[model samples]
Structure formats: structure tokens, C-alpha cells
Target: MEEWTVKVNHCAVKKEKPQTDQLEFGRIFTDHMFVMDYSEPLGWHDARIVPYQPLTIDPSAMIFHYGQSVFEGLKAYQTPEGTIQLFRPEKNLQRLNRSNDRLCIPAIDEAFILEALKQLIYLDKEWIPSAEGTSLYIRPFIISTEPYIGVAPSHQYKFVIILSPVGAYYKEGINPVKIAVENHYVRAVKGGTGEAKTGGNYASSLKAQETCSQKGFAQVLWLDGVEKKYIEEVGSMNVFFKINGKVYTPMLNGSILEGVTRNSVIQLLKHWNIPVIEEKLSMEKLYQAYLDGELEEAFGTGTAAVISPIGQLSWEDKDLMINNGTTGELAKSLYTTLTNIQYGKEADPFHWVEKVSEAYAVK
Candidate 1:
């Protein structure tokens, strides 16, 4: 990773930072952003961190028509000691490259990009809210910039990273949420770009998500595209269930995202000697577990919420209540532990938290 050039924002007027209580998700952005361009032969160059401004892209850009875009989400935390840190950010960047590969976009230099991200975070460290359950959300995205687009890959691309100070993902705090099982609509297929962190996959899920919202559900529980019986994941996160003292999550079957929070929960469960398995989990089996009085808990893990307990799951007008429609013991434990580690309230036994200064400096 090399040094990144920084251009200070000299605008006389600046947007006021929102109050900690008023910090909502993705609504407010920081003052600076990182950007880089890519083209054939020259590769990725002109790396710089400039003031946050609107982008001017041609209307005929390939990204506008072909939907060739990939993005990754992560957060920077302001510890109680006033230091900024990142949790498993390298994993997000690695997944970004994977998405790039799947979307036919150019792969990024993971280490260099990581360093650039750290520098950008450090530059806008004040944008990281100090309130509990709040942090600076980092969105790194790549869009195809080629104006003439047909069906093939584009030769030009732009990668940009922006920061947003976000409050809690759920307005009600970490309370359990109701989810509606999506039986008619499928989010992804096995042989498609399901596993990639791209916009199209999420754009395809909006209709189903909107339908669930009208039904008074927080999110949609997606089933497999082929069978529709096998569980895949929930909207924007990975799903997990506990039955008979054992935790189970749907395996990565080339159709579900490999979430960093999901992996961390699995590792944490195993470290505590809890039985955890990654396999093909079916909704029918989960419903059967509920019938047998063994369905103990259910939750969704992601960067946004970290751990969102699922209190009720509705399928075909039948609802299955888990943990008496409250946050489960395991879910609470996982959320507390993960947030503790993120905020530097507890020692990171897994060595996942990376301080900004060390991450920016070379060995």
C-alpha cells in the first residue's frame, strides 16, 4: 500500500453535523471521500481523497443500463478511549474483490485499498459518532463508466468510497423483528450472481421487501430460487436458527452472501463450545422444529444491525413465534459481545479490531 494524496476541502461553508440522537442511517455524509479511476493499460490510478461532492456521470454510462456495479459496507468505530477502529474491514475488501470478479469488474488491490480506507477514515475521524451504537458507515463501490454499452464488459470504471455517520439500524434498538417468508419471489439463483455484493441482486429484492413491509414485516426471508423450500437468507443479511440447543445457519450454496458478521457469530459460538453447523436448512424443517417445541431462537447477522433477532416468521398465513417474540439469550449475547468488541469495551480475543493508525502505517 502506498501513500494517498489528500486534497483538503476549502469550502467556506460546511454542513453541520447532526446531533447524535438525530443521526439516522445513510442520510448524512462526511465532508471528504476517496476516489480512484480504472481503464485499460493504465489500470487503477489518480488515487485521491477529495471533498464530498456530487458525481457527474454520462447518462449513457454502462452502469446506468447494464447494471455493472459492486459495493461493500463496513463501519469505523470510535472507541471509548477516543481511538477509531475497524472491525474485520479486510474481509469486506476481500469480498469486494470477489464481487468485482463476479460482476466482470476489475479487481482492486486489497492491501492498498485498505490503507487508503484507513487514511480516509482517519482524515474524517470526527465524523465517527461517539454515542453508543453509532459509528461511521463506509460504502465502497465500483461502477462501470464506459459510455457506449451493449452487453460486453466495460473498459472504464470508477471506484469511490464515502462515509456516513449512522445511528442504530433499528429505531427500536435491538428489539426482535417480525419477518415474512418470501415464497413467491426469489432473490437469487445458484448459477447467477447471487453471492456477489452487487446492486442488481438487491434491486431485484425491493418488490418482495415492499410487499413484506405492507404486511407489517421488517424484512423478507428469502427461499431458494429453485426449490423455494430450502432457506437461503433474509433481506440484506444471513439468517440463523437455534433448535434443541444447537445453532444452524444456511450454508453458502453459491446463492447467499458470505457475511462477515455471520462468520464472526459462528466462530464465537464454536469458541464457547456451542454446537454450530452450516448446512442446508429448510423452512419446512424450521417450521417442524417450531411444532416440536424445539425452535429456541432466530436472528439475522450483517454489518448494518450486527444481530437482529427474529421474533416471528410468517409463511402462508401461518406464523411461528420464536423465544416468545422477544430477543433470545443467544442473540443478546452475540450482539453484546460483538458490539463490545467493536467499541473497544472488551478485549478482542479473536484479534479482529484494527486500529486506524496501525492499519494506515507500513510494517
Candidate 2:
């Protein structure tokens, strides 16, 4: 592993930490963050741990114009024994590299970055919240920093990791939420940046999300960008449907994000001997399942929500009430099992959690 410099924030007055109960998603940040620079000749270098502060970027940076950036989200949970651990963090880093490949950005050393992240988390270990439904949110991102206006990949870039103590992604927590099916605005098309964890895919969805929010929907369920028939994702999470004791999620068709939680959910289902299928699921078919009373459950899975039940899905101005507008038994079980594994409350049969040792921090 590479040796990175560490600069502790020894300011006279430290920033006040928010109460775990009052913590909002991605709002309150820790005292320190991890940063690394990348240039054409030097590659990724100047890795350091410094105090949390804003970056001084050039006004003409490529990221500001061409939108060449990629990011990954994960969480660090504090166990009951006061040990900090991460849930499938390596998967997130691997996905980040996949996103980098799509964005024409230089690949990062995932092992080294994970080590640097562990060191950063260990340095700010106090920020890890122990409250139920709360964990330290980790945002690892890379941005093009070369100050150029040409429509091409930048030569300079910055990779940063910041931590935030968050309660729940949605204000409803694990409760069911109403979703509006997006028919007008398309999130991404096949052979686009949908599969990659990039910002442009999200930025394009905000307008539709905002439109649905005003209609009292928590989020918008995006359909396929080309034919607009098959389901792609729900808001920032991958969605799944349960019909007649079988689980189904949209297959990765180059337009859907392969979520870590989604994969875990499928694995857990298979572990329990439940039939789970990933295929092209259309809204009409799902509605028919609901009409036939076979739609047992619906939910969205992501690092933030873990498992968010879909109480109602509005499509074509008609509402499809799922599970009587309540959380399903399977959804609840998945949430409990995943959260327990993350917090070390249950035995991790899959060995997904990685503990962060104090030795990672630089003295």
C-alpha cells in the first residue's frame, strides 16, 4: 500500500457534532476528509488527510462545464461493541472504477483508496453514529479539475472522500413511500451513462423528481429511456417487485445501475431458497400482477435506504396500491437482516462487513 500524509485538524475550536437523532442525510460532515490528486505524468498522488474545507478550483474547470465526474456512496456503521465497520465497501470502490472507465477518467487504486478511507474514518471515528437507523455516510467522488473549455476528458482530476453522519435517506425511514412513474423525462438510454455512477445521470432526473415531489410523491420511478416501456430504476435506488411468492427486478440492460444492496438482496433471497429473477419487467405487466392480486410486494434498494417499501406507484394518473400501502413482510425482513449485518448485530454469513482498526490511523 502507498503511504499518504496525514494532517490532523488541531484548530482551537472544533466543529460541533450534530445529535444522532437530528442528523440529516449528507448534511453534517466530519472534521476531516481524504483527498488525492491526479495528473497526466504523476498519476494519483499527493494523497492526504486534511480538515474538512471547500476546494479552490479554477472557474473554467472541466467538471464545471463538461460534467466529467463520478461518485460512489456507502456507509460506516459503529457496532454495539464500539467498533467501526463498513458494508461491502470494496464493491463501491470497484463500481467507482467502472464509472471512471465510462467517464474517461484515470482508474484509482481501489485497495489504496480503501486503506486511505479506513485511515480517514479511524481519524474521525468519533463521528460514527451508534443510534438505530443511523450510520456514517461515505461519499467518494472524482472530479475533472483541468481548467479547459474543450469538450474532452480533463488531464487533471481530484479524488475525495467525505463522511457524514446520517439518520435515514427518506424522512419516512423504512416506511413505505408513494412513487410516480416518470413518462416524460428520460433518465438515461442504453449505451449511455446509466450503468455508471455518474452525476449527469442524476442531474437529469432532478427535474422529474421535483415534479413528482410537488404531486406528493416521494420519488419518481424511471422507465427505459428508449422505448419507455421497461422499468429502469426508482429515484436513486434500484427497484424490485414481488409477485406470487417470486422476486423480480429489472435486468442490467446498460441503462440500470447495478446496486450493491440490490445484489445483496438477490443473494439473500437465493440463500433463503426464494426464487428471484432479473429480467425485463414492464409497468403494464406489473400492473396486471397487481390487478390479479399477485403483486405481493414492491421496494427500492440502495446504500442509503437499504430497503424502501413502495406503498403506492402512480402510473398514467392511476395509482397502484401495493401491500395495502404498507411495508411488506419480505421488505421488513430484508431491512432487518441487512441492517443487522451492517451493525454487527447478526452473524454475517456472507462476510460483507469489514472492520476498521485503530491501527489504520496515523499517530
Candidate 3:
């Protein structure tokens, strides 16, 4: 495995950290961030952990012109005994490489980045919130930073990982959400960048999101681009549905993101001896299921929310309420189970949580 780091010139560990209960999601950042440079010829270099701050970039950087950027989001939680643990770090690493390949970004050695990430979290250990809903959110990204604005991949790039202290993603305490089923604007197509965590895929969804908001929906549930019938994914997370004691989700058809939370939920359900099916779930089938009263629940999953239940779905002058506009039994159980493992409240038999050694705990 490759390794790289330049010792921090100035450490920004919080002097008097605020209470975790008062935190807002992704607002309070830890003292330091990890950054590095990558070029075609030089590979990766100048890797370092620096005080958190805004980056200085040329106005005409390639990323600015061509949207050549990709990013991943995950979190580290402070257990009851004060250990910082990350859930399925390897999954994020693998997904990052998949995004790198799709975006033509230089990929870093996973071990190297993971090591650097843990070290940074160790240095800012005090900033990690220990409250029930608080966690240290990590955002790792790669961007084209070269001055030239040509369409081709830039020679210079930046790989950075920043930490933020976040409260639970469901600020309103997981009161159901309304999603506007998107039939006009598609989030990703088969040959598109949706499967990859590239910025362009998200950038393309902004307008649709705006339209959804204007239509009084919390999010836009996207469908396949070509057929416009099969459900693809929700705006930022993959979605799941429960019907008649079975769990079903859209298969990875190169038009949807394979989210970490989605995968975890699948494992957890299977562990509970529940049947899970990954197939093309279409809007018509979902509508029919809801009409038949077979659809028990629907929810979206991501690192941010873990699980957010969908209370209502609106499409073309019609409204469908899931489980009477309340968080269903399945949604509630899934959320509780996942968070239990995250905060060490439940037995993590799957060994999903990776603990940071006590020796490296910042004193």
C-alpha cells in the first residue's frame, strides 16, 4: 500500500468544544482537513493535513469549466465509551475508485487515504460529538485544479478530505417526507455518470430538485432516463420498498448510485432472515402495489440520514400516501437497528464498525 503525509504546520483542535446537542448537520468542522496533489506524470504528492480553510484556486480551473469533480460522504461516530468508529470504510474506498475511474480522476491508494483519514480524526478527536444523533461527517473529493479550461482532463488535481460535526440528518426528527416522482427530468441514464459519484450527476439534478421543491415535495424520486418507467433512485440516495413482508429495491442498472446505506440495509435485512429482491421496480408496479395495499413502507438511505421514510409520493395530479403518512414499522425498525450499531447501542455481530485504537486517541 502507498502512503503519504506532511505533518500539520498548525493544529486546530478545538479549545473549548461546544456541546454535541447544539450542533447542526455539516456546519461545525473539525480543526483540520487532509489535502493532496495529483498529476498525470508526478502521481500524488504534497499530501498533508492542514488547518480547515477555503481553498485558493485559479478562476479558470478545469473543474470550474468542465465540472470534473467527484466526492464521497461518510461519518465517524463517537461510541458511548468514547471511541471513534467508522462504518464500512472499505465500501467507501471501493466506491471512490469507481467514481475516479468514471470521472477520469486520479485514484489514490485506498490504504493511504484511509490511514490519513483516521489520523486526522484522531488529531481532532475532541471535535467528535458523542450525543445520540451527532457524528463526525467526512467528505472526500477529487477535483481538476489546473488553470486551463479545455474540455479534456486536467493535468493537475486535488484530493481532499474534510471533516464536519453534524447533528442527525433528520433535523425535524424524521417526520415523513414527500417526494415528487420525476417523470420529466431524469437523474441518470444508462450511459451517464449517475452510477459514478461525479459532480455532474448531482449538478444535473438541481433543476429537477428545484421543480420538486416548487411542487411542494421534499425530494425528486428519479426514474430511468430511457424508458422513464422503471424507478432508478431518489435524489441523493437509493430507495427501498417493503411489500407483504418482502423487501425490494431497484437493481444497479448503471443508472443509479449503489449507496453504502442501501447495501448495509440489505445485509441487515438478510441477517434478520428477511427476503430481499433486487430487480427493476417500476413506477407502475409501485403504484399498483400501493393501490393493492401491499406496499407497507418506502424509504431512502444514505450516509446523511441513514434512513428517511417517505410519507407521501406525488405524481401527475395524484397523491399516494404510504402507511397512512406515518413512519411504518419496517422503516422504524430499520432506522433503529442501523443507528444502534452506529452508536454501539446494539450488538454489531456483522462487525461493520471499525474502532480506532485507544493508543491513537488524541489526549
Candidate 4:
């Protein structure tokens, strides 16, 4: 992989480090970021790492009007052995390209951008939180920069990467969360940008999420837009259910985000010789399982939360509780296993953790 040029921040102003316990997700940013530009014929150029600052773009940039943007989230962990590592970063890059294709953004050179990311991470490696359950959140995004907004794809764009030291997704730790099944509003339909990590899909979900929040729910479990019968996913994570000693999740039906943690959960389950299935799971079937006392547990998987146990699921005015509204055995095991590998507490048999060596840490 080709290297990205580094421009040291001569006027670097380091902020006072917040107490680890006071750390919030996406609240505090590091001192530097990686940036690259794109334009017709020129392609991606002028890649460099610069001090974190406000961006200056045309007010009429297409991103402000047409919503031509995409983003990806991943984390860098400070291992117990004092090494910094990332989990399945290539998968995030691959998904970023998929999102770029869907949003008419030019595809980036995966290897090159990944190398650039590592360089950026190494430069800001100290920003990675060392507290338990804390890590550096990485946000890589692209936005349309073309000034003209005549309802066409932008010819110019900007790709940027920023880092934030995050504590944890849930303050309650890996406890169970309450979810409200959305029936009135749909997040995305088939043949839409559901699979892509674009801002529009998330923006369209805020109303539903707001409604669910007012009802004392943490997130909304989205059903398919067409029939509204089959389960799709949570607002920000892929969902899984354990019924009668078997695990099942909604299949990728062109309307679901393929989460890296979701895939890891499936692989870990299969590795343990547990039966797992990916298919269209209906809310009716889920409710029936609950009534029959077969629904053992449920959880949501994502890069942010990693493993969030779902204890209460409200659908059609019925509050169905799983595992007595507590984190189940399987959910706890999966969380422990996944975090162990991420924090270097155990051997990474899956080879998911990639190290950012100290050599690259020096500018």
C-alpha cells in the first residue's frame, strides 16, 4: 500500500484529557485528521493528515441540498499489552465502497485509504482510551462538494477521517435494552439505500426513533417496508434472536446492513457448534415463540455497542420480555468472547485484530 503524506500540526492545541469515566461517545475529538479530495480527471489526490479544524466549503455544495454523503464507523482498541489494534477494518472499507457506489461517489482505493487510516491512527494513537469498555471511535465519511445542485451527481467530493475517544455505547454496560417495534413508519424500502451507510437512511429513521424514545424504548426494531411482517433490523444495529436453543437473524434481503459484528457473532456461534440460521423472521413468529416460552434471548450487534442484549421487545401493544429482562447466558458469552479478542485478552483465532505499530506512530 502506498503511503499518505503527513503534515505535522505546528499549531497543535491539545485539549485537556477528560476523565475516562466522563467520556461520552463522539463527544471529544483528537487533535488531527486525515483528508483527501476528489474531482473529475484528477481523481483522489492531495491526501494528507492535518490538524482537526472546521471545514470550509461552498454553501451551495450538493451535500447540503441533495444529501449525497456516506460514512462508516469502526473502533481502535488499546490492548491489555499496550498495543493499539483495529478489528475487521477491511470489512468497513469494503462496505464504504459499497456505500460510495450506491451514493454515486467515486470508489476509493481500499488498500491506500486503509494505509492512510493506519497512519492517522498511529499519529493519534494516544487518543485511544485505555479504560475498560472504552476505545477510539473512527469516523470515515465522504460528502459531495460540487457547488452546482441541479439534481445530478456531484463531480467533486471530499473524504475525511476523524477520531474520537468514546467510553461505551450503553451506560448500563451490556445490560438488556427495551425496543419498540416500528409499524407505522418505515426506514427503507427494497431497491433503496438501506444497505448503504448513507445519511439519508439514518435521517429518515429519526422520526421513528424519536417516537420510540418517547415511549421509553432505547431503539426501534424496523420491520420490512413492503409487508411490514418480517423483521429487518434495529435502527443502528443488526438483531439476533435465540429461540429454543437455536440462533436466528434476519437475512440480507437488500434492505439490511451487513454488520461486521453481526457476522462475527454468527461465526462465533457456529464455531461453538451452535445452530444458527439467517432467514426472514417474522414478528408474529417471534411473539408466538414468546408465548410458547421458547424465546430464550435476543441481542443487537454493531461496531458501536458490539453486543447489546435485548430484554424487552414491545410489538403491537404487547411487551414481550426475554430471559426475565436480563442479559442471557449466550449474550454474555458472546460479549465476553468478542471483547476478549478485541482487547487482546485472548488469542485472536479469527485474525481480526490488526496492529498499528509504534514505528508508524512517529511523524
Candidate 5:
């Protein structure tokens, strides 16, 4: 494999950084971004780190018409020693390729992209917040840029990475939140785009999420699309339930996304000698477990929230209060441990943290 070089273009003007205490998730962006263009013969080329600005694409671009796009999310944390690091970034890049394969988009060189991401983060390292629950949120995405509006995959595409200084994903932070079981709209079915981290999967979930939000719920617990009886996920996050001292999460099954955070949580549980099972968990069975006083805890895992405890689950006019509407001991421990590892405050037994050196940003 040939090595790829990224060119850098500094921005003429800089934007004022937001106060770390008042930072909100995805609301503020950094000064620079990384972009690369792809075409047939040259493949992915002309990789560059440029000033953050609006993209100028043709109105008839295929991404606007057919939605041939894929994205991945991760974060960069500032440690107490002022070093910048990433958590399981390789997993995100691998998943991005999987999404590209599923969407019929061209595959990117994961190693090269990872280097480019490190350089980009190094350039904007100042934007990484050092607050208790703050970090620089990273969004990497690819979009079809071909001008043709037909229903086929595009020959041209663009890969971009942008950074955002973010605080907690939820206003409730690590506290427990209310969740509603979605019974109407389905997010995805087996043999669909659910397994891929694509925009269409999230676009299809807005209706159910909106309804639940209006009903005073923090998020909606999505059910399986075909049967509408099995638990799938919780509002953009992978869910896990603790019933009778065992942790259970819905199996991938070609529809549920393979979340990086979810995998880490399972690994952590196993490391602690906890039994974690992945299988098709039906809503009926879970509710029965709750009735039997076996559902001890419930939570959702994702890159943004990390671990959001599901305090109350409302299903079919029946509210299931989990752990007396408080964060469970295991959930709290997992959150603290994961965040501590990311921030370099604890020993990283899994070697999941990848440090970004200042030399990467040197011209």
C-alpha cells in the first residue's frame, strides 16, 4: 500500500472559543476541518486540512437526491496532563468501511484516514475541553457528490471530518431518564440499513423520537421492526437490561447497529465477572422480568451518552420503574470507569486510548 500525504491550509481568521462551562453538545465547532475528494481513476486523493467553511456542491448532487451517505462519531478527550487522546478510534474507522460497503460507496484506507484524523485533532487540540464531562466530538462522514440525480450510486464522493467542543449529550447528564417504548413507527428491519451507521436509519426514527420527547420522555426505546415485540435499541443508543443479575442486550441480527461503546461495556462487564448475554429479548419477557422483580437495572450505551441509565420505562400504559428511578450501581461504575479511562485518569487495561502527539500537526 502507498502512503498518502495530507496538505494543510491555515485559516486566515480564527473564531472565539466558547467557555468550557457553558459548552453544549454539537453546538459549537472548531477552527479547522479535514476534507478529501474521491473519483474513479485517482481514487481518494488531494487530502487536505482546510479552514472550517460551508461546502459548495451542485444542487443536483446525488447525496441530496438519493442519500448515498455514511457517518461515524467518536470523541477526543483532553487528559489532566494536557495530552489529547481518542478512545477506540480504530473501531469507528472499521465500522465506517462496513457502512461504505453496505451503501455501495467506495472504501477508504482506514490507516490513512486515521492518520489524517490525528493530524486534524492535533491542529485543533486547543478546542478540546478539560472539564469533568467535556470533550471534542468528532464527526466523520462521506457523501455522494456526483451531479446526476438518478437512483444509482455516485462516481464521485467527498470525505470530511469536523470537530465540535461538546459537554454532556443529555441535559440530565449521568442521571436516570424516562424512556417510552415505541409501538408505532419502526426504525429498521432485519436485512435493512440498521446495521450500517447511515443517515437514513436515523432519519426514519425522527417521528417516534419526537412523539416520545413530547410525552415527557427522554428517549424512545425502539422495538424490532418486523415483530414490534423485541427490544432493539434506545433512541440512537444500544440498550442493555439487567434481569436477575444477568445483563442482556439485543443481538445484532443484521438490523441493530454494532455500537463501539456497547462492545466496550460488554467487555468491561465480562472483565468484572458479570454475565452479559446478547440475544433477541422480547418486550413481553422483559416486562415479565420487571413484574417478577428481576429487572434490576437498564441503560443505553453510545459514543455521546456513554451510559444513560433508563430509570423509567413506559410501555402500554404501564410504567416500569427501574432501580427506584435512580442510576444503578453497575451503571454508575461503568460510566465512571469508562470516562476515567478515556481521560487518562485510570489505568487502561484494554489499551483503548490512542494518544495524539503535537508533532502530527507540525507543517
Candidate 6:
């Protein structure tokens, strides 16, 4: 693929800044954006950076009607050396194409997209937050833009990448969050679009998320769509389990999001000789492990919250508490290892972090 034509158009004003001390996730955005269009005749053209503004789409856009859209979430960290770098962005690009393949959306060449993103982020380097517990959040998405309602794949599509300067996910600092084990509603089904990071999957979970919020939980612990006995994942994140002296996560069974963080933790655990297994983990066995003192801890891993320890898992009138109602030792180990590599504090044995150099936004 040839280099994507890059143009810098800056936003006029910053959206009301969130208190850097109270940075909430996904709330504050930068001043510039990168967008490209694709049509059956002209694939991926008009790649440009424009002012961060509300998008205008036709009422009959495919995204609004037949639900053809996919997205990715990752972050740009301000390294200790003061350079902005992305954490394993190639993995994200790979997953984006997986989603594209699932949704019948044409693939944007990964290297081409990465260069465009680097060029765009270089232009918005100033937007990369430097304060402790703050960094630039990157959201890249694609929508079927053909103005029609027939429900077939759209002839036109739009791909956009936007950056948001965000503070830490928790204003109170990195603390353990309570999660509820959902028994009734399933997040994704077997042989479905469960693994794809499409907007519809997220939209289907809003009600469940609301229920979790109402019940005073941070997120919902989803199980297999059919069996409903085994573990799956959390909202847009993958789940990890620490049982007895071993670490376990549900194997990638074509129904769960394969998180980059999850893979990183598994690699680091192996590096330390910590026995880690990826297999089907049943909720029945999970609760039994807790009762037998075999289940020591649990947590969810993703780009948004990093490795968030699950302090409590409540379900079916059964409440299982994880180690003193606070952060687990395993959680701390994984978090430190992952973030250390991310911020360049430790050697990246997996070569995951990708550094961004030179700016592209037309300043």
C-alpha cells in the first residue's frame, strides 16, 4: 500500500478539560482527527486530519441502520524519557482487521494505517498528557457510510482515528473494583460476533452495564452464551483468574475478545515460571475453588483499566470475596509487569511497545 496522504487540520478549542487529577476514561478528546474514506470504486481515499468535531452522517447511513461498524481502543503513553509511544499498536491493528473480516468491511492495510496514525499523533504530540496517571487515549473506528437502507454491505465506508487525552480511569487512584457475575443476560454468543469489537456488541451490553451500575458494580462478568457455566470476559475486556497457586483464563474459544494485555500477562507469568493455563473455566468450579480456598484472586485486563483486580464476585445469591476485599498479589504483579514495559521502566522481553517519532498534524 502506498503512503496515505496526510493533512493536518487543527481543532479550534479544547473541550472543557477534565481535572487532570480527576481524569475519567474516554471523556476528554484532543483537538485534531484522522479520517479516510472507502468506496467500491475508490478504496480508502481522502485521508486527512481535520478539526475534532461532531460527525455529520446521513440518517440512512449503514452504521445507523444495518449496524456495520467496528472500533479499537488503545493508549499512547508518555514515556519516562518524554516520548509518546503506543503500547502494542500492531496487535490492535491486527484485531481491527479481524473485526473487519468478521463484518465484511474491507481491510485498510495495517502498515499504512499505522503510519497515518503516527503521522497524525506526531502532529498532536502536545495533546499527549504528561502528568502522572494521565495519557492520550486513542480510539479508531470504521463505519459503513453508504446512504442506503437495504441491509447489504455498504458500497461506501469511512475510517476514522481520534485521540483523547485522558486521566487515569479511577480518580481515586488504582484500586480494586467490584464486579457482578451476570447470570441472566449474556454478552456474546458462540459462533457469533462475540470476538469482534463491533459497536453492536457494546450497544447490546449497555442495559447490562446499567444493571451492574445500579447494583453497585464496576462491570459485568459474562459467561458463555450457550452453556452459561464457563467464564468469558468483562465489558470490552478479557478476564483472568488466580486460583490456588496457578493462573487461569478462559481459552480463546472464538467467543471472547483476545486482549493484548491478557496475552502480555500470560507471557510475563511464563517468564517468571508462574504456572498459567488457558482453558475453559466453569463458574461452578470457580465458586467451588473459592470455597476450598483454591481461588485466590480474579481480575479483568484491558487497555482502559489495565489490570483491575476484582475484589468481589457476586452472583446467584452467592458472594465470593477476593483476599481481604482489596487488590490481589497476582493483580499487582501483572499490573506492575505490564505497565513497566509500557512506560519503559522495565525491559520489554516481548518487544510490545512501539515508539512514535515526528509529528503529522498540520501545526
TM values, all candidates: 0.96, 0.97, 0.95, 0.97, 0.98, 0.95
Please give, for residues 1-363, the per-residue lDDT of candidate 5 as tens digits: 266789999889889999866898887899999999999898999999999999999999999989899999999999999999999999999999999999999999999999999999998888998878889999999999999988998999999999999986655557999999999999999989999999999899998888988889989999998999999999999999999989999998988999999999999999999999999999999999999999999999999999999999999989999999999999999999999999999999999999999779748
* Count of clashes, each model: 0, 0, 0, 0, 0, 6
Off by over 4 Å in 2: 1-12, 169-173
Model 5 vs. true fold: TM? 0.98
Q: Taking the tens digit of each residue's C-alpha lDDT, what string does model 6 give over 96-167?
A: 999999999999889988988888788778777777667888999999999999979888999999888887
Lowest-lDDT window of 10 residues in candidate 2? 4-13
Across 1-363, the per-residue lDDT of candidate 1 in tens digits comes to 355453444335557888989998998998888889999898988887877999899998999999999999999999988989899999999999999999989999898888788888887777899988999999999999998868889999999999999997766668999999998889999999899999999999999999989989999999999989998998899999999999999999999999999999999999989999999998889999999999999999999999999999998879999899999999999999999999999989999999997444322
Q: Where in model 5 is the C-alpha error above 4 Å?
A: 170-173
The residue pairs found clashing in candidate 1 are: none
Runs of candidate 6 with Cα error greater than 4 angstroms are 10-19, 359-363
Model 2 Cα lDDT, one tens digit per residue, 1-363: 456554455335558989867898888898988889999799988888888899999999999999999999999999899999999999999999999999999999989888889989998888888877789999999999999999999999999999999985555556899999999999999999999999999999989989999999999999998888999999999999999999999999998999999999999999999999999999999999999999999999999889999999999968899999999999999999999999999999999999999789767
lDDT scores of the candidates, listed in order: 0.91, 0.92, 0.86, 0.91, 0.94, 0.85
Write the number of the candidate with greater lDDT, choosing between 1 and 3. 1
Please write out the lDDT profile of model 4 over residues 96-131, one tens digit for every residue: 999999999999998888888998898887788898
Give the 10-residue window scoring lowest on summed lDDT in candidate 3: 1-10
Candidate 1 lDDT (Cα, 0 to 1): 0.91
Candidate 1 RMSD to the real structure = 2.0
Which has the better lDDT: candidate 1, or candidate 2?
A: 2
CA lDDT, candidate 2, residue 89: 92
What are the runs in model 3 whose C-alpha is more than 4 Å off?
A: 2-6, 12-18, 359-363
TM-score of model 1 (CA atoms):
0.96
The positional error of residue 259 in candidate 2, measured at the CA in angstroms, is: 0.5
